[model samples]
Target: ARRVVATLSIGKRSHFATARVAMEAYAKRVGAEFVVVDSTAHASLARWNATLHSGSNSHFMKLPMLQWFLEHYDQLLFLDDDVLVSPFAPDLFSSVPCEAFGAVYEGYHKQGWHSMHARSFCSLYGLA
Candidate 1:
């Protein structure tokens, strides 16, 4: 069984602080190890790898933090602060495919790919 840890980054914003509190409660309820990355304090550490093109996008910092978690954990669940974990949410670590990265599709488009949003555009233009 792969040991899993949950992680989230919190900026200096107030909303993010509230989100962190919620995430911490969720982590406690699920009996999972929770890691909080302080974007305001350790922003420089995340820039060690120039290839990632981290820029001002604090979300990119998760890359280095994820790597660090990988060293100590078998798998990592990187959740955004904005996400609200439901009590009914399934155990994700057990469902993740072996040797493959897993992510949920936001399902913004029900028809063709043409209706996809900015993320699709970034993928197409190689900017993401």
Candidate 2:
């Protein structure tokens, strides 16, 4: 299956520099193409915004990005530009079923921020 690992990097904040090298190497090792989309680029953002409900906000770009990638590639692993992949980490896609959606649980964050947010989100959505 054709596989890609991609991220959106907006503005000039050195969005992917710190993590790109490691992630690129990991993508190579895992036989997946690595891509970094600069959302600030006119054509890139324009294309994403063309999708229904897509907006100019950088955070909202993920939906359109996922839509485009899933249409073109068999599978994609999307990551935030701030994320760093460890050299010792295993191939993340190998263990999952291709048809299933997968995500890493960040509720275990050291500061409990994600956990707290999740709880609040659950309560707000009446899922608690």
Candidate 3:
């Protein structure tokens, strides 16, 4: 057995079934369970607001992974739709070991297109 089980959250049932099926097929080949956390745009977003406000506005529509985050996931990953996973995913979860962690991305934006607005309109000049 290569892995125990890899868990990830899904915004909806049919959002990425094709890719999910491919992943499920691979995981089955290696004896693993792919847990899909069914989530929503409304409920999850509301929860995100309740838990965190202010800077949360920066991320816009994408549902933050905290809603469907599975604590048991040894190396819990907050993923988005555009991710590409290869069949040879060896050492996928070898390095991470922390209560909370995220890579320091060097200028990358992954979401809908929107124009940058004037900070004078936003509180704290949105320096947050």
- How many residue pairs clash in all the candidates, one count each? 0, 0, 0
lDDT of 3 by residue, 1-128 (tens): 22333334454534354445445654565455554445434443555555555654535434354433443344444444323334555533354444556553646655532112212212222322
What C-alpha root-mean-square deviation, in Å, does candidate 1 show against the real structure? 10.6
Task: Assess the local accuracy of residue 65 in candidate 1 as a C-alpha lDDT between 0 and 100.
Answer: 64
lDDT of 1 by residue, 1-128 (tens): 34544555544544455445546666665556777666534533444445446454454656666776676667667787555554456777767854668997765656655324434534543545
TM-score of each: 0.57, 0.71, 0.41
Show the colliding residue pairs in model 2: none
lDDT of 2 at 115: 55
**Candidate 2 TM-score, true structure as reference:** 0.71
Clashes of 2: 0
Across residues 1-128, which tens digit of lDDT does each residue of candidate 2 receive? 98999888777856356567667988999999988887545343555565535543455767766877887778899988767666677887886667988898754467867456545544643546
Q: Is candidate 1 or candidate 2 better by TM-score?
A: 2
Window of ten residues with lowest summed lDDT in model 3: 113-122
Q: Could you give the candidate ranking by TM-score, starting with the highest?
A: 2, 1, 3
lDDT agreement of model 2 with the native:
0.72
RMSD in Å for model 2:
10.4
